[model samples]
Target: MTELLSPTLGGAAAGLGVAMPMGAMSVLLLQEAMRHRRTAMAAAAGIAAVDLAYAALATGLGPWVASHIAPVEAWVRLASALILLGIAAHGLRTGWTAPTPPAAEPRGPATPTPPAFEERGPGRSPGRPAPPAPSGPARPAKAFARYVGLTAVNPTTALYFAALTTAQGASLATGAAGAAFLVGVGAASLLWQQALVAVGALAGARISDTARVWTFRLGYGLVAAYAIKIAFPLPTPG
Candidate 1:
């Protein structure tokens, strides 16, 4: 492992460096922080896991995979773009149709009624309200699954690792050197993603109630924008 130090640090730096750019995934990370304040860690873990896996794949077998998959690159990009668009559309619909918080109950003579969904269950008093269901689908495991799926299909990630590994040539791509680089990548990726989660959570905390609602609406819009950008990138100059 000591011999691999150089490669590891190099890989880690590269991995962390590449991940710093803000994008659709960043939005989702921030969203998770805002929603499950406590579970952001889990989501971060998931993001890290995908990063490490991609790093390893890029270093270990990127050339072979890239070559074999080249034929279908366009399809993969299209599918990824479509998936993003679908998610954005669903979020937009859900946000639009979401019920407004019920009016704060007036204090005084009449007892206030609970929202229909929050009505008391068996063994509970009629007046007692049930716990509300989660506003979005962001359980830790689900968040993890989501990141894994999104990152897996992200062509840019695969290409980044592939380019880096291939650029190292045969000399740097083998044995202890290669191992070290992968290690570095994993470490760097872990650190960066966790920081993003923390930052997101902090942002979530600072936002006002009204801001939270608008933020959600804005996130959906941004995601849709990302999807459109992905699906229809501008043509390069001739």
Candidate 2:
């Protein structure tokens, strides 16, 4: 019971730790929530689903990677450190450049210009009719699938799960304990994602662009520090 409980707790902590960072993805989630509640909820679920998948995969793969890493431990660590540093650098760059959400769009009663729509035809002609604009709300299922792919492709997140799995030890990655851990990860991540969506839907406009920028910077800064720690390990006591 204790063994299972420990992994479950660890997985919950791991889930929150990974999901708490507010990056571009978080901003996008918030923005969508403000405009389309159903789509945003679906997206949040998709993101959590990906996290659960990554956690499960990591739980199974970490032990194998550790066993085989002895021959090239230094190289593997170096590579992992580099990957993390790259992610941090990209995050920092985007943090400065990422566009503010629609909430930050100029607030004044002015006629907004309609952007030009794309024309699909064999050739441009005066008689060619522009495609009709979409008249309905965004599809929730599409949002779900899109977010699932977006979350799945995030390398930093993948590495995070891998790190957590390796740290959790092989003993906890089997049978009931493993199942408990996966459940914890899924539940915690889903709850967090939903909370973000709710906040966006309820009061996203209250958040400032500066706050978003700083949040992104801070999250990536921590990642960079972790990468540095990995790159330069402390010497063990004799």
The TM-score that candidate 2 achieves is 0.64
Q: What clash pairs does model 2 have?
A: none
**Tens digit of per-residue lDDT, candidate 1, span 1-238:** 5667767766765555445433345445555565565566676677677767766776777445434555554444455456545554654454344333333222333222213321110011223233332345467777677666655555545644554554343435456787777777777777777876776666643323364355445544544454454444333333
- lDDT for model 2, on a 0 to 1 scale? 0.62
Instruction: Go through the candidates in order and give the C-alpha RMSD of each one to the true structure.
Output: 12.7, 9.3
lDDT for every model? 0.52, 0.62
Predicted structure 1, TM vs. truth:
0.53
lDDT by residue for model 2 (36-152), tens:
678889989998998899888988887577666655554555665666667667656654554333342223332122112211100112222322222233699988987787667
188: Cα error in model 2, Å: 1.9
Backbone clash count for every predicted candidate, in the order shown: 7, 0
lDDT of 1: 0.52
Q: Provide the TM-score for each candidate, comma-separated.
A: 0.53, 0.64
Superposed Cα deviation of residue 123, candidate 1 (Å): 56
